[model samples]
Target chain A: MEKKVLLGNEAIARGAYEAGCHVATAYPGTPSTEILETIARDYREIRSQWSPNEKVALEVAAGASVSGGRALAAMKHVGLNVAADPLFTFSYTGVNGGFVIVNADDPSAWSSQNEQDNRHLARAAKVPMIEPSNPQEAKDFTKLAFDLSEEFDRPVIVRITTRIAHSQGIVELGERQEVPVKPFVRNPQKFVMLPAHARPRHVFIEEQHKKLKEYSNRSPLNRIEWGNKKRGIITDSVAYQYVKETCPDDSVLKIGMVWPMPDDVIREFAAGVEKLYVVEELDPFIEDYVKALGIPCTGKEIIPICFELTPDIVDRALNGKIKGGAYPKYETNPVPPRPPALCAGCPHGFVFTVLKKLDLHVNGDIGCYTLAALPPYSAMHTQGCMGAGIGMHLGMEKAHGPEMARKSVAVIGDSTFVHSGITPLIDLVYNKGTGTVIIMDNRGTAMTGHQDHPGTGKTLSGEETHTLDLELLVKAIGVKRVVVTDPKNVEELERIVREEVAAPEPSVIISKRKCILIK
Target chain B: MKNVIFAGVGGQGVILASKILMEVAKNAGYDVKESEVHGMAQRGGSVDCNVRYGDRVYSPLIPREEADFIVSLEMLEVMRKLEYLAPGGRLIVNTEKVNPAPVQTGAMQYPPDLREWISKNVKNALFVDTSGMLKEVGTRKALNIVMLGILSRDLEFTREQWESAIKSLVKEKFLDMNIKAFNLGREYN
Candidate 1:
C-alpha cells in the first residue's frame, strides 16, 4: 500500500470505493460535498450522482441499498434535517446490501448557518454512528461503516467535523474489495413501513440497538491508552487529537463509535482513572452519557460548549488556567473585514443590481446569489434555507395582499430551484397566488464549487445528460406567465421584472446566464 | 515541528501554495497536516490555511502566537493573522493589497502605515514585491508560487524538492512560468 495525502472527505470517498460501494449520492453542502465529488472524479467503477437535495439524495441511496447494492449518502449536519424523513424510516426498514450516511458536522458554524451536532440524530433514529479522527481513520472507518451496516442490517452514520473534513493527512491506499451484490428479496414485512409492518419493525430496531451496544463495547474502534492514572480523558473524532496533544500524560479513552456509546467500556475506563473528563466539540454528548451511567466526568463546564476546540484550549482548561491564559494577545489593530462577494461578472450580480434599482423586496434562496444580500447591490430582503424563497414570497404576497405583493419577487438559483423550489412554485400556481419568481439559472450549482444538478447538462460523473429547461418546467407547473431573459440585458430584465410583478397571475422571470466562475 | 499560516483573499491561491508546501514537507519524509477554508468564503473573502509538519502532528490548528512562519499573500490579511506569529517568527508577506468590501465601498480606508506599523511591531518581517516580481513573469497568477519561492528560502527543503513539488502540482502549460516565478522568489532579497 502506498501512502498519499488526502482530505478527510476524499478519504471517505476512498473508503467507500474500497468497500465496493456500487452507488453514491449527495447534494453539494460543504465539508461533505467533496466525498461524492472525489468518488465521481477518481473511482470509475461506482456510480456517483448529485441529487436535487439531501432528502432526494438519501432516498436515491436508500433505493440502491434496497436493490441489494452497496450505497452511501453524504451531506452536512443541517442537510440531515432535510433528509431526516427518509433517514428515520430507513433505520426501521434496514438494508439489503449496506448503506452508510456521511454527516460532516460544522461545530463552530464555519461555512454553515448553524452549528448542529448530528450525533443526536443518530441516536434518535436508532442508528450506529462512527466518528473518524483524521484522514486515515476517515478512510478506514468508512469501510468499517459499510460492514457494520450490513452486519446489523441497518444504515450507519459516519460523522466528521469541519476540521477533519478539510484537513489533509497521509492515508494508506488499498485495493477495492468487490463485494458481490445480494439478490433483491421482496419482503413487504421488512421493506414496507405501514402501520402493522412498522409496529414489529420498531421492536426489531430496539433489538438491533441492544446488539449494537454490545458490539460497541468490544469494537476495535473503541480503545483505551494508559498514561497518568490520576487523570483520564474521554474524546472522539478531531477532539481526540487535541486531547492527545494537550494532555499527553493523561490516560485517554478514544471512542470511535460515539452513539450507543459503549457503556461497559466507558464504566470500566472511568473506574480505572481517578478523574475523568469528556473532551468533545459542540455538545457534551459523551459527558452526559457518562454521567447518566453514574460516573463523574468534567466537560462543557470546564471546556466550552460553543465553537471548535484546539490543543491550547484543552491544555488551558484542564490545567486550571483561565480562558485566554494559554497565549499572549498580540498588539495589532483589527483589519478591515473581507466578506464574500458576488463575482465581478456574475449574472446574479446584474440581476441584483437591477433589483436594487427597482427597490423591490427580493426573497432569496441559498446559493451564490445569497451574496446579493450584501454590498452595493443589496437587492435581497430575506433569505431562509433552500427552497424557502418561493414559499416566503407567497406568504408575503398573501399577507400584504396583491397590491404590496406586486412589489415583491422570489429569487432562487437554478440548482436551488431543482433542490426544493419547484414544489413551492407549484403552490403559487395552484393556490391562485400571484408571486413573481426570478430563477437565477446560472447553469450549475455555483456556490459549492460548481457541482452538476438536474438543470446542468452533466451528471456528477461528468456525463452529458438532459439539461432541464427552467422556463418550460415553470410553464408545465401551471405558471401562466413565464419569460426567459438574460440578466446581462439590464434594460430588458428590469422591464420584464416590473411587468411580471405587476401582472395579476403567477409569473416566472428566468434570469438566464452562466456562472462567471464556471468555465 | 513547523507551523505555517498562509493568509490571503479568495482566488489568490493561498490554499494551493499551502498544498504545495505540504507536499514538499511530506516528500521530505515529515508528517504533515493542513487546515483550509473552502466553500462560501472562497468568494473574494479573507481565506487562510494552517500547514504544520514535523515528526508527528496531532492537531492541524496552530495556536495563537505559535506559528513559526506566516506567509501572507495580501497585506491586510497579514495584519488580521499577525497574532498567530510567534516571537522571532518570520513574516514573509506579499506587498500586494486587496481592498476589502468596506474599503472598496469607501466605508473604510486601507491602513496607510501598514509597512511602518509592521516593521515597528515585528522584529523579522519581510515584504516581497510580488506584483513587481510577477511582472517579469508576465502574470499575477504566479504570485503565489513566487511567494512560495521566497518561503522556500527559509525552509529546510532543497531547490530540487520544491521544483518537483511544483512540477507535480502545476499544470503543464503554466509549468515553465511557475518555475521562473519560483526562481524569482528564491532569488528575492
Candidate 2:
C-alpha cells in the first residue's frame, strides 16, 4: 500500500470511494466542501453533484439511498440545521443501500457564523455517529460508517471539526471495494412516511437504537489505551489527539464511536482510574453523559468551556496553570490586522461599490459576497444567514411602505437564490411588496471553493448539464419587471438598479458575471 | 523533532511554501505533520501554517515557544507569530511589508520601528530583502520560494533535494525563474 499525505476531508472522500459509494451529493461549506470536491474530481465511478443547499443535498442523497445505492452527503455543522427536516425523519425510514452524512464542525467559529456541536443532533436524531481523531481515522471511520449504517439499518453521521478536517496526515490507500447494489423494492409501508406508516417506523427506529447501543459497548472503534492508571482522559475526535499529545502518560479512553457511547466500556475505564477527565470541545457532551452515569469526572470547570483547545491549553488546564494565566507570553510590536476582502476583480465588488454610492440599504446573504460588509465597500446592511435576504427585504418593504422600501434592496448569490431564495421571491410578488432583488449571479458557488450548482451549467463531475436561467425564473415567479445586466458595466448597472428600485413594483436585476477565480 | 512556522498574509503562498517543506521532509523519510487555515480566511487575511517533522509527530499544532525555525514571508506577519519561536530559534524573514486592510483603509498605521524591534529581540534573525531579489527575477510571486531557499541553508537536506522539491512544486512555465530566485536567495548575505 502506498502512503499519501491527505487532508482529513480528502481522506473522508477516499473512504467513501473505497466503500463503494454509488452517489455523493453536497453543498459547499467550509471544511466539508472539499469532501465532495475531491470525490467529484478524483472518483469518476461515483455520480457526484453539488445541490443548491444543504437541505436539498441531504434529500438527494436520501433518494439515492432509498433507490438501493450507497450514498453520502457532506455539509458544515450549521448546514445540518437546514437539512434537519429530512434528517430527523430519515432516521425512521432507515435506508436500502446504506447512507452516511458528514458534518464538519467549527469549534472556534473559524470560517463560520457559529461553532455548533452536531453530536447532540446525532443523538437527538437517534443515528449512530463516529468521530475521527486524524486523517487516517477520518478515512477508516467513513468506510466504517457506511458499513454500520447498513448493519443497523440506519443512517450514520460522521462528525469532524476544523482541526481534523483541515490538518494533514499520512494515509495508506486501499483498492475500491464495490458493493453490489440491491434491487429497489416498492414498499410504501417502509419508504413512504404518511403518518400511518411513520407511526410503526418510529417504533422500528427505537428498536434499532437499542441494538446499536448494545453493539457500541463492545465495538472495536471505542478502545481503552493503558498508561498511568491514576488519570484517565475520555475524549473523542480531534480532542482525543490533543489529550494524547498533552498528557502522553495518562490512560486514554478514545471513543471513536461518539454516539450511543459505549456505556459499559466507559464505566469499566472509569473504575480503573482514580481521576477521570472528559475532554471535548464546545459543549461538554461526553462530560454530561459520563456524569449522568454516576461517574465522577472533571471537565469544563478546568478546561474552559469556550474556544478550540490546543495541546498547550490542555496541558496547562490539567496542571492548574490556566487559571493563573501561565501560558506563553512574548514581547513584539503591534501588527496590522489582515481582514479577508473581496478579490481584486470580484464581480460582487462592482455591485457593492454601486450600492455604497447609491446609499442603498442592502440585505445580504451568505457566500463570498458577504465580504461586502468589510472595508471601503461597506455596502451590506443586514446579513442574516442563507436565503434570508429576499424575505428580510420584503418584510422591511411591507413595514415601511414603498417609499422607504424603494431605498432597500436584497443582494444574494445565484446558488443561494436557487437554495431558498425562490420561496421568498414568490412572497415578494404574492404579498404585493415593491422591493428590488439583485441576484449577483457569479455563475457558480464562489464561496467554499467553486463547486457546481444548478446555475453553473455543469454537474459536480464536470459534465455539461441544464443551466437555470435566472431572468426567466424570476419573470416566471410573477415579478413583472426583470432585467439582466453584466456587473462589469458599472455605469449601466447603477442606472438600471436605480430605475428598478424606484419602480413602485416588485422587480429583479440579475447581475451576471463569472467569479474571477473560477477560470 | 523540528517545528517550523510559516507566516504571511493570505496571498503570499504561505500554505504552499509550508506544503513544499512537508513534502521535502517526507521524502527525507521523516514522519511529518502540518496544519493550515483555509476557506474565508484565505482572502487577504493573515495566514500561517505549522509544519513539524522528525521521528514522530503526535500533534499537528506546534506548542507555544516550541518552533525551531520561523519562516516569515512578510515583516508584520513575523511579529504576529513571534510567540511561536523557541528561545534561540532561527528566524528567516523576508523584509517585504504588506499593508493590511486597516492600514490600507487609513484606520491603522504600519509600525515604523518593526525591523529595529525584531533586531533588539531575536539573536539569530536573518532578514532578506525579498522584494529586491524578486525584482531581479522579474516576478514577485517567487518570493516564497526565495525565502525557502534561505531557510534551506540551515537544514540537512542537500541542495539537489531542495531544488528537486521546488521543481516538483513550482509550475513548469515559471520553474527556471524561480530556480534562479532560489539560488540568488541562497547566495544573499
Candidate 3:
C-alpha cells in the first residue's frame, strides 16, 4: 500500500472508483464539486457529468442504477432539498444496483450559503447515512456506502462536511472491483412504485432498515473503546476523531453510520458507560437518536449545535484542560463590510457598476454577480436561489405595468439561467411580462471554484464537449430581443440594461465575461 | 522541533511560504504534517496553514497554543490566530496590512500599526519589512517566502535545505529564478 496525500474530495472519488462506480452525476457546488470532477477526470472506466440540476442528477443516477450499474449522485447540502422529492420515493422503489448519494455538507457555510444539517433528510427518507472523519475514511466510507446500498437494496447517503471534503490526508489506494452489467428484469410491481406496490415496498424498506441496523450492531464501522466509564462520548465523523484526541482518557463509542443507529449496540454501550455525552456538528442527530432509546445524554447543550468543532473547542466544551481562549479567535476589525466583491478587473464588475449607476432595480440571481449586492456596484436589489431573479422580475413587471418594469431588470448567471432560468423566461415570454433578464455568462461558474456548466463547452471533468450557446438557448425559448455584450465595457452593459428594461416584450441579455479565476 | 502556523488572507502567499518551510524541514529529514485549507476559503478569505515538525509527527492537526512560531502574513490574521502561538513564543509579522472578512463586514475594528499592535497584545513579537524586502527583490509574490527566509535565521533547517526546497517547489522552467530569489532572501537576513 502506498501512502499519498490526497484531498478528501479526491479520496471519495477514488473510493467510488475503487468500488466500481460506473456512473456518477452531480451539480457543481463548492466543497462537493471536486468529487465528480475528480472521478470524471481520473477514473477512465467511470462515466460522470455535471447534471443540469440536483433533481436531474438524482434521477439520472437512479436510472443508471436501475440499469444494474453502480451509480453515485453528489450535491451540496441544499442541493439535497432540490433532489428530496425523488430521494424520498427512491427509498421505496429501492435500487437494482448500488446507489450512493454523496451529500457534501458545509456545516459552517465555509463554502456554502447555508449551514444545513442533512442527517434529518436521511432519517426522513429512511436511508442510512455514513459520515467520514478524514480523507482516509472519506474514501473507505464511500466504498462502504456503495456496499451498504446494494446489501439493503436502498440508496445510502454518504454525508460529509466542508472540512472533511477540503482537508488533505494520506490515503492508501485500493484496487477497483468491477461488476458485470445485469439484464433489465422488468418487474413493474417492484420497480414502478405505484401506490399499490409502494405500500408493500414501504414496509419492506422499514424491514430493510431494521436488518441494516442489526448488521451495523456487529459491523466494524462502529466501535467501542474501553476506558474510564465516566465522561463517555458518543460521536461520529470528525467529532469522533476530535473526542479521541482531546478526551482520550474517556471511553467512547465512535459511530460512522449515524442513521438507523444500531439500537442494540448503542443500548449496550450506554449501559456500560456513565455520564454519556454526545459530540456532533450542526445538529443533535445522534444525541437525540440515542436519547430516544431511553438513554440519558448531554449534547448540543454543551457541544454547541452550530459550526464545526475542533479538538480545542471539544476539550473546552468537555471541561477538559485546554486553556481558555486557546483557539484562534474570530477577527475583530471595524472596517467597511466587503462581503466578497467582484474583482477590480472583473468584466461582470463593470456591468453591475453601470446597472447601479443607472439606478435600475436589478433582481440578481446566484453567481459572481451576486457580489453586486455589495459595494460600489450595489446594483442588485433582490437576490435568491438560482433562477429566482427572473421569476421575481416577472412578478414585479406583472404587478406594475411596463413603464414601472422599465426601471427593473432580472440578472442571473448564465449557468444558473440554464439550470432553472428557462421556466421564468418562458413565463415572461408567454404571459407578456415586460422586463429584461440579463444572463451573466461568466463562461465558467465563478462562485463555486470555476467548475464548468452547460455554457462552458466543457464537461464536469474539464473535457472538451459541446458547449451550449446561451443566445441559441434563449432564442429557442422564443425570446425576440437577445443581445450579447462584453461586461467589461460598463457603458455598453448599462445601455443594454436600460434599453431592454424599456422593451415591450420579454428580452434576454447575455453579459459575456470570462470568470477572473478561470481566465 | 516545533510547530509553526502562518495565518494570512488569500494572495498573501502564506500557504506557499508555509509549504516552502515544510518542504525544507522534510528535506532535512524531519517528519512533517502540513495541513492546508483548499477550495473556497482561498478566494480572498482569511486563510491559514499548519506546519508541525519533529522527529515524529503524530497527526496532521496542530494543537491550539502549541505553535512555537507564528508567522502572520496579514495583520488581522495575526489577531485571529494569536492563540495558536505559545504565550512566550516569537511572532514574525509582516508590517503590511490587509483587512479581514470581519473588518470588511464592519463587525470588528482594524488595528493600527498592526505589527506593534500584535506586539502589544502578544508576549514576544518581531516586525519585518516584508513589503520592502519583496520590492527590493523585484517581486511581490515572494514576500512570504522572503519572510520565511528571515525566519530561517532562528529555525532548524539549514540555508541549503531552504534552497533545495525552493528548487523542489517551483516548476523546472523557473527553478533557477526562484532559487536565486530564495538565495537573495537568505542573504538579506
Candidate 4:
C-alpha cells in the first residue's frame, strides 16, 4: 500500500476512484467544492460533471445509479437542503447501483452561511450516514460506504464537517475495485414513485432501518476502544480526534455509521464506564441518541453548542476548567477585522457601487455579490439563500406595489441564476410582477473559486461547451424588457436600471463581465 | 509537535507555503496535518493555515497560545494571529502590509508601529523587510517562499530537504527563479 498526505477532499476523491465510482456530479459549494474538483482533475476514469444545483446534481447521480453504475454526488450543508427533496424520496426507492452523497457541513460558519448539522437531515431522511474522523477514514469510510450502499440497496450519506473536508492528513492508497454494473430490469413499482409504490416503500424503509441497526451493532465501522473506564465518550467524525487527543484515558465508542447508531455498543460502553459523555460538533445528535437509550450522558449541558470545538475546548469542558463554556482567553489586541469583500476590480464591485450611489434597496442572493451587503458598498438590504432574493423582490413588488418596485432591485450571480434563480424569474413574469432582476453574469461561479456553470460555456473539466445566453433566457420566459450591458459602465447601467424599474413591467438586467481572477 | 502558521491576506500564498512545509515534514518521516479555510474566505479576507508536524499530530488546528512559530506575509495579518502564538513563540513578520477593506476605505486604521509592538510584546521577532529583497528575488509572488526560507532557519530540516520539496512542488518552468528566491530568503542577512 502507498501512503501520501492528502486533503480530506482529495481523499474522498481518491476513495471514489478506489471504489471504481463511474459517475460523479456536484454543484460547487465551499468545503464540498474540492471533492468534485479533485475527481475532475485526478481521476480520468470517472466521468464527473457540475450540475446547475444540488438537486440536479443528486438527480443526475440518481439517474446513473439506477442505470447500474456506481455514482457519487457531493455538496455543502445548505446544498443538501436544496437536494433533500430527491434524497428523501430516493431513500425509499433504494438503488440498483451503489450510490453515495457527500454532505460536507461547515462548523462555525467557516466559509458557509450556517453551520448546520446534516446528520439530522440524514436521520430525517432515514439514510445511513457514514462519518469519518480524518483523511484516512475519509478515504476508507467513503470506499466502504459504496459497498454498504449496494449491500443494503440504499443510497448512503457520507457526512463530513469542514474539519474533515479541509483538513489534511496521511492516507494509505488502495487499488481500484472495478465491480461490474448490475443489470437493470424494468419494474414499475420500484422505479416509479406513486402513491401505490411509495406507501409500501415507506414500510420497506422501516424494515431496512431495523436491519441497519442490527448491522450497526455488528459492523466493524462502529467499534469500541478500550481505555480508562472512568469517562465514556461516544463521538464520531472529526470530534473523535479531539476526544482521543484530549480525553485519551476515556473509553470511547467512535460510531462511523452515525445515522443508524450502534445502540447496543453505546449502552455497553456506558455501562462499562463511570460517566458517559458525547463529544460532537454542531448538534447533539449522538448525545440525544444516548439519552434516548436511557443512558445518562453530559453533552451540550457543559459544552458550548456554538462554533467548532478543539482539544483545548474539549479538555477544559470535561474537567470543568472553564465556566459557562467560555472560550479560551488570549491576551491580544483587537485587530482590524478583515471581513470578506468583493475582490478589487471585481465586476460585482462596480454594480454594487452604482446601486449604493442610487440608494436603492438591493435584494441579494448568494455568490460573490453577497459581499455587497457588507461595508463600503452596503447596497444589498435583504440577503437570503440562493434564488430567494428574486422571489423576495417579487413579493415586495406585489405587497407594496409599483413605487417599491421602483426603489428596489434583485441581484443574483449568473451561476446562482442557473441554480434556482430561473424559476423565480419565470414567477416574476408569469405573475405579472414589476421589478428589476440583475443577473451579475461574471462568466463563472466566483465565490466558490470560479467553478463553471451553464452560463460560462465551459464544463467543470474546462471543456468548450455551449454558453447559456442569459438575455434570451429571461426574455423567452415572458419578460418584455431585457438589457445586457457592462457592469463597469456605471452611468449607462444606472440609467438602464432606472428605466427598467420605473416601467410597470418585469425586466432583466444582464451585467456582463468576467471575474478578475479568471485567466 | 511543532505548530506553524502562515498568516496573510487571501492571495499571499499562505496555502502554498504551508503545503511546502507539510511535504518537507512528511518526507522527513513526521506525521503532519494541515488545515485551511478557502472559498468565500479567500475573497480578499484574512486567510491562514495551520501546519502541525510531530511524531503523532492530533488536531490539525493549533489551540490558542500554542503556536510554536508564526510566519506572516503582512504586518497587520501577523498581529491578528498573536493570540495563537505561545508566549515564547518566534514571530517572523514581513514588513509588507495589505490594507483590509475597512482600513482601505478609511473606516478603520491599520495598526501603527507594529514593529515597535512586536519588539515590546514578543520575546523573539524577526521583521523581514521585503522592499530590498524583492529587487533581488525579482518577484513579489515568491515572498511566500522567501518567508518559508526564513522559517527554515529555526526548523530542524536540512537546507537540501527544503530544496527538494521546492523542486517537487514548484513547476519546472519557474524552478530556477523560485530556487533563487528561496536561497535569497534562506541567506538573508
Winner of 1 and 2 under TM-score: 1
Interface RMSD of the predictions, in order shown? 2.8, 3.3, 4.4, 4.2
Candidate 1 lDDT: 0.90
The Cα error of candidate 3 at residue B94, in Å, is 3.1
lDDT of 2 by residue, A268-387 (tens): 999999999988888999999999999999999887678888887888887653332112333444556788889888999999989999999999998888889887898888987789
- TM-score against native, each model: 0.97, 0.95, 0.90, 0.97
Instruction: State the C-alpha lDDT per candidate.
Output: 0.90, 0.88, 0.79, 0.88
Q: Per-residue lDDT of A148-188 in model 4, one digit per residue for the tens?
A: 89888889999988989999988989999887877888877
Clashing pairs in 4: none
lDDT of 2: 0.88
lDDT of 1 at A437: 93
DockQ for candidate 3: 0.31
Q: How much is the lDDT of residue A440 in candidate 3?
A: 79
Which scores higher on lDDT, 1 or 4? 1
**Candidate 4 chain A, which ten residues in sequence have the lowest lDDT sum?**
A322-331
Classified by CAPRI criteria, candidate 2 counts as: medium
Clashes of 1: 0
DockQ order of candidates, top first: 1, 4, 2, 3
Candidate 4 docking classification: medium
Q: Judged by TM-score relative to the true structure, which candidate is superior, 2 or 3? A: 2
Q: Give the number of the best model, judged by DockQ.
A: 1
